[model samples]
Target: MKNKSIQIQEKHHKELQKLSESLGQSYGGLVEKMILYFKRTGIDPDDLKNESPTYKIQQLDKRLVSFLKVQERAILKPLRQETYEYYENHNKTLKEAKSLINKKIVQADQNSKIRTNNILKEIDKQREALNSICEHLDPANKKGLKTVFQNIFKNAN
Candidate 1:
């Protein structure tokens, strides 16, 4: 048989040469290996060599379907149910946590308002007591009123 040569671009030829060198094989050896691999896999090398874009897309789709079917039969079964339950529990927990936080916030706000009101009432009572003492003081008993005021402040401290 007469040997024929396939012409390739310089860049592609250099790439092939580099690949062959890296694999420790000659160009002819690489070609032979590829032919053997295609034969063993029952794939026609000519079909791949002249593959159209549409044909390649169809082949890819077939591969994807097969891959998905395998996954559906194996990994997806356990994960699908677990994923649903996880999200259900997660949403329920989140709602409960939000309700608890809201209740705590409302309670804290009510407590703050109650404390403020109590402080205002106490201040009013103190002002009324001071006014009463001032009104009850006798004009001739200034020293006695001053002593009483001092005793009140001392008791308070």
Candidate 2:
């Protein structure tokens, strides 16, 4: 093995010595173990990978996204329910309006039919009065203007 020398601050060396004592290792042995750990993990011993705020922020971002998804579902559930209820109420109202319109249409048809029947009855009474006048004018024969008037009245009826 080759010997190498590296200089460190006095305070850092003292801290290293304290760590070495706590670990029940010589300072040089502790340094060797740290170097071995770096070689095995392919990481620098001084790098605060897990303890850095950047890593904690990334974890917090993931948890925040999950929490937002839960909140989104919780908020949308009531909105969806209200939307469904609104449409259902509108549909029922539309159905009621349609039925009312249909009833009005039926009533109008019945009224038109009644009016038509009344007009027909009036026409029949007018024809009968004309026929009675024709009978008065030609009581003896069944021919001439009385026959023509009877034919016209039959066709009209």
Candidate 3:
């Protein structure tokens, strides 16, 4: 489409720019859409010229363009900045938590391996102790050795 320039107030242009961004359209497209809406609603664009003075005055009193500018500068801009900061902090916290979780997982794995190794070592020690007792006990001393083994099992339980 061919582009044409028209004179419009700065605040009106800013409002249009904001509207364009929000609607994801060019300012010209937005204007075209607005015109289409008016046409479909049976409102004649030319009739604006014959509008009552009070209605026109009320339109001016609304100060929508100024309101949009104030909202952009005083409220929206700061809110946007704070939103960015919030995301940054939230992302940082998530990363740190992930790192901590991974570290804990690794530590748990290491602890599990150590516990297994300790259990194996204890088994080996008990086997060696049993072998020593068997080797030391003669046939005549077997009864005493059997009593000692039964007491060891009782203590184990």
Candidate 4:
């Protein structure tokens, strides 16, 4: 390594020496690392030291961007996934409920039709039985039965 000396204030030199010792590095290495860090990050040490508004705004912007990215990853992504899953499950449940209701309605319609047909058949049998009874009755008995039926109906009304 080429050894060279650069003039600096005594206080600055002493501070640099202390930093180098604490970090267990040579003065040249420490200074080179500091320069590289500043260059890589596109930071101006003078801007930081001067506390410029523009520099403060830039730092704030970086922090805000970082916070947004973290929120997106840690909160937004999972919440969105859970919501989508719930939406899908709710839709599926609705479909199942609709299908079940439709099946039940169809079954009820079929049962009602069967019951109606059976009731019609029973009415027809009762009409036939009444006609046979009328045919078997003598003229006098028929007259008496008709009078009794009329009186019963009149009382009901």
Candidate 5:
């Protein structure tokens, strides 16, 4: 295709150059990129010409515009609908997964609490058994046994 050139102000030219640099592109390349971007975004850059007060309606090929309109609708309509549907389903699935995870977390926490309570009860039983054994010992033997039992209980606690 043949390319055309347009004149821009020096300030705009400098700005374009900076933009091109930031985008890792050349000035001409940047213009081409912008054209493609506008096309993809469904914005006709030519339509902006109407902003000028003195602008005249150029001869537009009606058949070409109609064809483009039909093609655009054919291509974009279903895609837009499908995109919305996809997001709707995706969000629903995400919420379901989060709910499942939360349920599992609550169950795990309850299990952990039950296990901790059982462990504490077992330790109390052991302490009671030690006290009963100390009570049945002779006075001389009780002193040394009581000290050992106290050390064990302190360490366990």
Candidate 6:
């Protein structure tokens, strides 16, 4: 291995010596370990005391969760409300259409019943006339039957 030398402040060197004693490592060994740790993790050693990678990651995670919540409130809540309203409107329209159809069906049924009643009344009137003519014919009066048929034809006109 090659030897290299670098100068540092006296106070910083003493602090490093204290840390090396606590960690049971020589000063040079501690410095080597620190350099390896910073290089491998891409962490800035000067900013370690102010903000660590763990703290930054936690902050980012919290920001992500808060952003998701904001997006939900801003985007999804109104969409859900609009969808519900649209559904209700369609449902109401369908109900109204169904009601109209039912009313039309009922009116058609009533009209059919009235027309059927009128036809039946006409049929009953014709049946009474036929019965009356048949009664006159029972006596075997041909002239009387002919006179009754002529009167019936005149009344119809």
Q: What's the TM-score of each model vs. the native?
A: 0.44, 0.57, 0.48, 0.50, 0.50, 0.65
Candidate 5 Cα misplacement greater than 4 A, ranges: 1-60, 138-141
Candidate 2 lDDT tens digits, 1-157? 8767779999999999899989999877899998897788676656766354577789899999999888878987778999999999999999999999999999999999999999999988988887788789888646675788778977866
**Residue clash pairs of candidate 1:** none
Show the colliding residue pairs in model 5.
none
lDDT value, candidate 2, whole model? 0.86
Per-residue alpha-carbon lDDT of candidate 6 for residues 60-142, written as tens digits (9 for 90 to 100): 99999999999999999999999999999999999999999999999999999999999889977986777687666755655
Estimate, for each residue in 1-108, the C-alpha lDDT of model 5 and write its tens digit. 777789999999999989998999988889988889777866565685543322322234566688788988998888899999999999999999999999999999
Model 5 lDDT, residue 140, Cα = 62
- Per-residue lDDT tens digits for candidate 4, residues 1-157, read 8888789999999999999999999999999898897888777787736565588899999999999999999999999999999999999999999999999999999999999999888866875666557556844564676556546546754
Each prediction's whole-model lDDT (CA): 0.83, 0.86, 0.84, 0.84, 0.82, 0.86
Q: Write the per-residue lDDT of candidate 1 for residues 1-157, one digit (tens) a residue.
A: 6666889899978988998999999887887797797778676755748675588789999999999999997899879989999999999999999999999999999999999999988976886687577657754565677557657766865
Worst 10 residues of 2 by lDDT: 44-53
Q: What TM-score does candidate 4 reach?
A: 0.50
lDDT of 3 by residue, 1-157 (tens): 7888889999989999999999999888899898897778665767746675578678887888788999999999999999999999999999999999999999999999999999988977986688577657744555677567657766875
For candidate 4, the lDDT comes to 0.84
